[model samples]
Target: MSTLTKQDTFQSLLDSASSSFAPIRTQAKETYLTQGLPALKEEEYKFTSIAKKLESKIQEFKSALPFAVSKEDIESVLFEGFDGDVLVFSNGKYLPELSTSPEGITVSSLSQAENTPLGSIAKPEKDAFSALNLASFSDGLFISVPKKQKVEKPILLISFNQANSGQVIQPRVWIEAGDFSEVTFIDHSISQTEDPYFVNKVVEIKGGLNSHVNYYRLQNESKNAIEVSNIHTDIFQDSRFTSVNLSLSGDMVRNNLTLNLLGSNSEGNMYGVYLLNGKTHVDNHTNVDHTIPHAESNELYKGILADQSRGVFNGKIFVRQDAQKTNAFQQNNNILLSEDAIVNTKPQLEIWADDVKCSHGCTVGQLDEEALFYLKARGIDKNTATGLLLYAFAGEVLEKIEEESFRSYAISLIQERLGSKF
Candidate 1:
C-alpha cells in the first residue's frame, strides 16, 4: 500500500462529492494536485504564509456535517436598513426561503444557467485556492441583467455559516451585466457558530459594452474561521467597474482581486479597508491588466493594525504592449497602532507601452502623536482624538461607497471597533 499524501487525500475528498460540474471539478482537482498550495517563498506570496495556515487546518476540510439556519436567524444578522434584493446561502447551499426574488433581472442556480456565461470569468489554473473552490463548490448564485435595462436597486448576497467543528464551505457567485446595463452588487459573509470552519469563495463578474457595475464585499466571520476568496472581473468597451472590500475580523483571510481591461476606453476602480487586531491575519493581492488602448485603472487600500496583528498588501498593474494611452494608479497606506503590530505593503507597475501614465506608491507609519496632542489640547479626550484621526484616515475609502445606508452602517461598525462612544 502506498502512503496517502495530502494531495491524494484532497483528491479523494473531491471524488466523493456529486456535482453537475464534474468535468470542471476533475480538471481543477488535477491542477490542485499538481500545483498544491502556494508557499511563502513564492514572490507573489512572499509576505503571506498561506501554505502554513492551510497545513495547520488541513483536517477541517475532510468532512463537513450538515448545518441548517432559519430565516429569522438570517434576518437577525443583516445590516440594519438595507432594503436591497437578497440571496441567502447557508453552509454553501442556496436558501430561497430567506431570499427576496430580484426584479428586472434573471436569478437562477449556477447549474441552471447553462446557456449563459457561467464559468467564463474564473481561471482556476492560475491559483490553487480558486481551483479548490471550483472542485468543491456545492451551489452558487448566477445573476444576469438584460441589455439596456438598469437594476433600480442593489442586490444583496448573504452567506451564512452554521458549522460544527472541522467543516469546509465553498460559495461561488457569477454576475453578468448585459450591454448598456447598470447594477450594484453586494456580498456579505457572516458566521454564527463559534466552531472553527473554512470558507473558500470565488466571484466572477463580466461587464459588457457601455455597462456599469458596482460591487462591495463585507467579511466578518467567526474569529476562529479561515477564509480565502478570489474575485475576477472582465470589463468591456466603454464600461465601468468599481469594487470595495471591507475586511473586519477573521483568523486568517486571503483575498485575490484581478481586473482585466479587454476593451478600449474601459474604467476600473478598486478600494479596500481592513481593521485587524489580536493575532488575526489579512492579505490582499490585487492585479490590474490593461490589454487594450485608452483604459484607466485606480486602486487604493488602507489598513489599521493593532496589538500583535499582521497585514499584507500587494498591488500590481500591467500594461500590455498594445495598451497605449493607459492611465493606472495604485496606492497602499497602513497605520500600525502598537509596537507589536506588523504590516507589509508593496505597489508595483509593469508597463510595456511608452505612451502611458502610471504611478505606484505605498506608505507605512504610526499614528501622528502631534495631531493627537493638538486634538487633546482642544477639549477632546485622548481616546476620542485617536478615534477621530483614525476615522479621518479611513474615511477616504468609505466615502467612495455609493450606497448611503451601507456607508452609514459601515461607519458605525468602524466607530465601535475604534472604541469611540460617539
Candidate 2:
C-alpha cells in the first residue's frame, strides 16, 4: 500500500456519500479530482492564493480534532437584541437549540427540505471550490418563502466556528423566493478562537418572478481566520435583488458574488465596504450578467486600508447580445492610510448589446491633504478628522442599506472600526 500524503488527504474529502444526492457528489468528486485546486497564476484567482491557504489547513482538517461550540460561545457574538429569526451554525452543523425560525417561512435542513433548489443555482462542475463543497459538505440551510408572501422580519444567519487546533468548516445555504414574495437576509460570520480556520461557505439564491430579495453579509473574524465564500443569485422577470458585503477583519478572506439578471425589467444592485488594518487581506470579486432586455444594475465598493494590510477588488459586468437597453455601472474606490498599505483594483465591463449603456471605473489614493488642513484649521484633531472623513467615504455604501435596524447596526460597526484605526 502506498503512504497517504497530504494531497491524498485533501482528495479523500471528495469521497462519494450514501445519500440521495450521491450521484451529484460523485460527479463533482470526479470533476474535483480532474481539475484539482486552482493555481496562483489563474486569472480569476491570480491575486489570492486560496488553494495554498486551503492546503495549509488540510492537515488540521485531517486530524479531526474534537471540536464543539457552546451556547455561551454563541452569546458572545450575538447581535444585541436583534429582532428576527436567528439561525446558528457551529463548525459545519446547524444548532437548532440555538436557533429560531420565523413563523411564516419554511426553514429546514437541506436534506429535509422538499423540492429544494440546492444544485439549481450553483454550478459545481464549473468551479473547483464549488466542486469541493458539493462533494464534502455535511450540513446546510434550505429556506423557502411561499409565493406572494411578504416576510415581516428578516432572517439572520450566524456562522460561528472555534477549536483548539487549526480547523476547516464548510457551510452551505440555499434560498428560494416564490413569485411576488419579499424577504431579506443577514448572513454574518464570526470566529472566536486564536487557532486558525479555513472557513469555506457557499450560498445560492433564486428569486421568483416579480419577487424582492435583499442579502447583507458581514464578516468579522479573528486575525488567524481564512475564509473563501461564494454567493450566487438569480433574479427573474421584474424582480429586484440587492446585496451588501461588509468585511471588518480576517487574515485572508475572498468573497465571490455573482448576480444574473435572467428576465426583462429585472434589477440588481451590489454594494460593499471593506476596512483593513494590520496584515489582513480581503478580496472582493463580483460578476453581474444581464441576460435579457430592459435590465439594469449598479455596483459600488469602497475600502479604507491602514497599516500593512492589502485589499483587492475585481468587478465585471456583462451585457449579452440579447440584453438590449441595459443600463449597467460599476465603481470601486479606495483610500490608503499608510505607505505600506496596498490595493489592487480592476473594474471591467463587457457589452455585446448595441443599445446598452454600461461603464466601470476605480480610484485609489491617500487622504486629502487639503481636507485634513481644512479640518485642523477648525481645531479638529488629526485622528478624529481622519475617522470622520473615512466614515463619510464608507457611509456612501452604508446609506444604501434599506433595513433601518441593520443600517444602524452597520453604521455603528463601521464607525467603531474606523475610530479604532486612527
How badly does each model clash, as a count of residue pairs?
A: 0, 0
Q: Which runs of model 1 end up more than 4 angstroms from their true locations?
A: 1-9, 63-66, 116-119
Residues 1-422, candidate 2, lDDT per residue (tens digit)? 11222256455444433365677777777777777767776788788887676556545353223256677876666566567788888776677777886878888888887666465677776567777788777767888899999998888888777754445677889999999999989988777687776777889999999999999988888988888888999999999999999998988899989999999999999999999999999999999989999999999999999999999999999889999999999999999999999999999988888998888899999889889889989998888888888898998999888777778888888888777343
Off by over 4 Å in 2: 1-6, 16-20, 56-60, 63-76, 164-166, 420-422
Using lDDT as the measure, which candidate wins?
Answer: 1
TM-score per candidate? 0.96, 0.94
Error of 1 at 292 (Å): 0.8
Worst 10 residues of 1 by lDDT: 1-10
Give the range where candidate 2 is weakest over 10 consecutive residues by summed lDDT. 1-10
Judged by TM-score, which candidate is best? Answer: 1
